[model samples]
Target: MTDIDLNQILTFVKVVDSGSFTKAAEQLKQPKSRISRRLAALEKALGTQLIYRTTRQMQLTETGKDYYQRCAPLIQDLENANNAMTSHSVELSGVLRLTAPEDYAKMILAPLLEEFLKKHPKIKIELVLSGAYLDLVKESIDVAIRIGTLKDASMKSKRLSSISSIVVASPGFLEKNPAITKPEHLEQVPCLNFNVGQKNRWRLVKDKQDIRIKANGSVEANSPELLYHFALYGRGASLIPEFLCRDALQSGKLVHILKGWTSGAIPVHLLTPAQKDIPAKTKAFMEFASARL
Candidate 1:
């Protein structure tokens, strides 16, 4: 009798799953004769029949069922162990690519990332910041920090929080329009929008109704940093994130407007591609940022 090999056991499992010797042979990239020969050898070596085969079906024997249940998890564990060891070597000390929106990158993620770098000194992080949605697989990014709504179904996500949006203006700008009290009053005042050359429309919800208002500011920019500086110079009222202007509102450089109406909150999420198992480095970063962000 021939000795049973590990490859034979794996091939047996595949053949059982595929339910046809020809199909299993095709999947394993081998000839049907060789596949049948291997299974016969495996059964001979074990001194018992594993599978009872028919023309249209293949069913496991009692011994085969018990053996498979015992061996499948062991095979999976061995594969996982191999992958973990190899990934730690290929992944731990290499660069991890990430992406995010500019405002979140500059104001929220940068400082937190700096601290993370200090902790994992060997791993390098490269960040791509943009307002448009980035393709995680096409860009080969390990992860992305995104705000607003996440509509992509192909990726996995862990939500950080729902950040509040506030209507803010420079104290001097608010001084010029002192009659503002409710949400609809925004239509009468000079408003700022950050769409650059695009249409300057602002949407907010109050008392279960959605309202859209067109902005009428003298300045516009694609960059939130530029818009922030413009708001500081008393250009006009800009709708901005509460977290971004938290210090300014506290310091009285900017004042809150439309206190009764709000654009609601946007969710922050950490997204990654749909992989079989997440890598150790990606898992580490996710755990760190999930708590910190």
Candidate 2:
């Protein structure tokens, strides 16, 4: 091909991602006819069909899939390079895509974003709230605020904060049961478990020694808030993040148990794919979350 058309390829990629000429045009802010013509020109240049068009939708052919996988990263890298050059500006611009857990997104991040948007009106952020671990490279996400520890060696991680899990129970429940003085005594109490692991097993440590105890409980939940509610109603003892239960503990709604022992410290991480030129938007948002959270 004569000086392979980069713009045409970008337009084609946008069309493929959007799955419609009109949608691509809206995203690219171009005319629909222009997008159609660009895709046609790209196909002619490659001398093979890239997309299989249908009345209702569009699908990528085998060659198109390969090309997309190759070009998407290149296009993103170029955009990142361009963004990096302007990253030091006082005013933030462009899109910032972030991913984090559901509770953090709701209880912590949503309020922060509300204040952030008020300060910087030019930036647009797309927040994906999920419980599963996400691949930043495959999804083209700018940053991820992860809760646990980081195991991936390919990414740059900054420890935002350390969260320690606190075991709590209602006054009435504790009144019925004896005070928890040792780790083994927990077996006698009704324990509310989160999504950490099996119902009966809890990993804890004391005096530089690790201990695993089999906990018994009637209430099991996937959410910390639900467990908090259950503990409030005298259902069972629950281990939850200190940030979530600090207020409740102060108000005497929940009583902290085993004050001398600790469950573990969960490191909150801010992860980003190793890129040469991180965008200003991403950097600004990362700094904001780091400063606030």
Candidate 3:
């Protein structure tokens, strides 16, 4: 109807999507009172109550539900049109918040971020590193680089690459231990376990044959970097991502075991929140990382 009405409808859509006025305000970068007033004004202008508010929860009324269903797609289409028009002309500038595993951030993302920042001097980055999966909306994360199978169907994902695991141990440990000639030999030796809720089972494939073994290990950790270090110090053999221990393998500090048998490959993905319009800086970083990593 009016320009102010259009703005209020956008706010209403955001509140519905976010499930609360407080969260919607945070996302829209506005005060909670302002968001409340806008919604109230919208109701007065339209002569219909859209939402039933409570201290603990919010629910859309019958009218609100129908209105929201109609408005959401129209709003999304408008945003897409706006982004398409301004994308090429606008120089991307903003804080792009990202999250990833601690070890991967240190080893892989550090250099890429540096390069990306150099290219776009106006953009700033905030990186959160953790072993556990963080909720993108809850944490306000713009992008995430994750390794393994994705469980959250709500988030959008782009597969970057598949990382292969290598079973490795130090030269000294191998000298003292029994020869690990076949996949079965792994069960006899002390193996470093990457604990991720599963049992200490290592699956290897060789020449169309699949073998699974329950690896016995004295040290078990959730972090791959720790496992790599333990293997380097001659503590035990470990299954780790090839990129993490590439330098050690090259320097002869760690030796690749079970040469013919291969550990399975884990899929790496670039994750983003399921939203209609992605921020330019976040999209730019995703593109940059997808090409390089």
Q: Which candidate has the highest TM-score of all?
A: 3
Which 10-residue window in model 1 sums to the lowest lDDT?
Answer: 84-93
Cα deviation of 9 in candidate 3 (Å)? Answer: 18
For all predicted structures, in order, the TM-scores are 0.72, 0.66, 0.73
lDDT of 1: 0.81
Q: Per-model C-alpha lDDT, please? A: 0.81, 0.83, 0.89
| Model 2 TM | 0.66
Task: Give the per-residue lDDT digits (tens) of candidate 1, residues 80-185.
Answer: 7887787556636678889988888888888988888887788889989887788888989999988777889889999998876678889888777756776667
The lDDT leader among the candidates is 3
- Give Cα distance to truth, residue 70, candidate 1, Å: 12
lDDT of 3 by residue, 1-293 (tens): 66357879999999999999999999999999999999999999888899999899999999999999999999999987787567557887888899999988998889999999998888888999986789999999999888888999889999999887888999999999999988888888999998885479988887789888899888999999999999998999888888899999999999998886667778999999998779878877887899998
The order of the candidates by TM-score, greatest first, is 3, 1, 2
lDDT of 2 by residue, 135-199 (tens): 99999899998888677979988888877777788999999997888888988889988865546
